[model samples]
Target: MTAPRLKVFSGNSNRPLAEEICQHIGMPLGEATVTSFPDGESFVKINENVRGHDVYIIQPTCTPTNQSLMELLIMIDAAKRASAHRITAVMPFYGYARQDRKDQPRVPITAKLVANLLVAAGANRILTMDLHSQQIQGFFDIPVDHLFASPVFFKYLEQFKGDNMVVVSPDVGGMKMAAAYAGILGAQLGMVWKKRTNATTVETVNVVGDVAGKDVLLVDDITETAGTLANAAKIMRDSGALSVRAAVSHALLSPIAYERLALGHIDELITTNSVPVDTRGLPIKVLSIASLMADAIVRINNNESVTSLFKIKGF
Candidate 1:
């Protein structure tokens, strides 16, 4: 079968990651002019012809959330108008995913809203990693290829598999992810009881499971303020845990998170480079997911099954 002509372009958000992905796929990054007007308007122009091509726009809705999202939408619209055969939005880190539901009386589901925006902007499909809620995929009218960061984290964590390790969820909600980590690493499972004091604060109540004298690894989909991980680490340490570390998929570190990580309660933070993260001299190890994403892109372009990529250590 003849392969579809594939072209990949990137927005201003996390250009380094897109470049890495291009390198992994053995292709040069597509030519594009993405800039800002003096009035703060985003300007995007595809310098190369994308007519009838399977186009993928690499843009992560990272720190400057609104700008990145706007850039992606504009890029998608540009591709659609330029007569691309298929347009896929490659979002390594999806912002506004936390507002997936309405727990409050009158709140908007930004995740769904973003999904609508993507569809309206002419995205035929989406590729993202480790969403805040898995259900967010259901909101999209277009096909969403949700990728997990576990495969990348697993290889980096294999060295500590034989240690007396306990994979813990920093909060009640993250139990499922922790359980998966525990099952894959062949470690004990644990959970931390916590209450959200505020948006940026988390108060840990207690720790469950046996963590005494064992190395604790907290697992979560995302960490912005680091309150949950830091507080959980403190409680685990107080409960006689030998060491406390955290393995988070997306670490959107805020100023508060930087301060918390500097406290040293958590010995190390293992995370993926879904978004651009600055270590800032902290003990942060950012594992790259570029190769994994590149492979997935190739599979998607080839119309191949991505099931094998989802498997983790025979689990």
Candidate 2:
């Protein structure tokens, strides 16, 4: 039996990753024209025949987030109008994910808003990776295939696993992720309790677990200013940690992040190409998720189970 025609399209954000995904899936990039009008409005036109085909629009809402998000929405709407059998918004990096809830008064839940917008724009499903919060999955009323970058991290961290290793969380919110890593790697779990003094300043209150003479792995979903990671690394080192390395899914490191990284507080920063992070000779190691996303797209098109993408053995 012939496989149903599967088409993949991309937006201005993270085009290289989309191209890599197409290459991994052994498919040609779909024909689409995305441009902006003289008034800075996004305009999208599907150039190829997509009627009755399963279409996947890969757009990571990274930097220039609002613009990229608009492009994704428009693309999904175009696919739906063109009579695609199904449309999945393959977002490697979901923007506005940090605002998943209303912790403060009069604030908006932008994550939920994004979910509604995607569905309203005719996305039948969503394929994303390492959302800032797991509950962000529940924001969508539609079927959401939330893939993790853990497998990608495990594949790389497997080599560095041994005695005297501990996974550390830079904040209380990340204890769950750190615990998962600790359980998978058979290493100890540690947490750095932090208090935000200001927008960009963080104070490490205390270390919860032992790190004397042990290599530490700090796990986080994203790093913007990197103040938290750098402060945690300093605290870990002061507490006798042999080394402090960070494994984060999204590396949206800013200028200060690079400056802090150069301070030698963090030994290594491992991240994925979920965003265009420039290592630029810093001790940052970037892994690719193109294969992982490619496989997920293939399985979704074939109607196969994607549960095993979350399992890990020996980290």
Top candidate when judged by TM-score against the true structure: 1
**RMSD in Å for model 2:** 1.3
Worst 10 residues of 2 by lDDT: 306-315
lDDT of 2: 0.93
Query: Residue 97 of candidate 1: its Cα lDDT?
Result: 96
Query: Which regions in candidate 1 have their CA more than 4 angstroms from the true location?
Result: 313-315
Candidate 1, 206-299: lDDT as tens digits: 8889999999899999999999999999999899999888999999999999999999999999998899999999999999999999999999
Clashing pairs in 1: none
lDDT of 2 by residue, 154-259 (tens): 9899987777899999999999999998988889998988999987889889999999999999999998999999999999999999988999999988888899
The per-model lDDT (C-alpha) reads 0.93, 0.93
What TM-score would you give candidate 1 relative to the actual structure?
Answer: 0.98
Cα misplacement distance, residue 272 of candidate 2 (Å): 0.4
User: What are the RMSD figures for all models against the true structure?
Assistant: 1.1, 1.3
Error of 1 at 278 (Å): 0.4
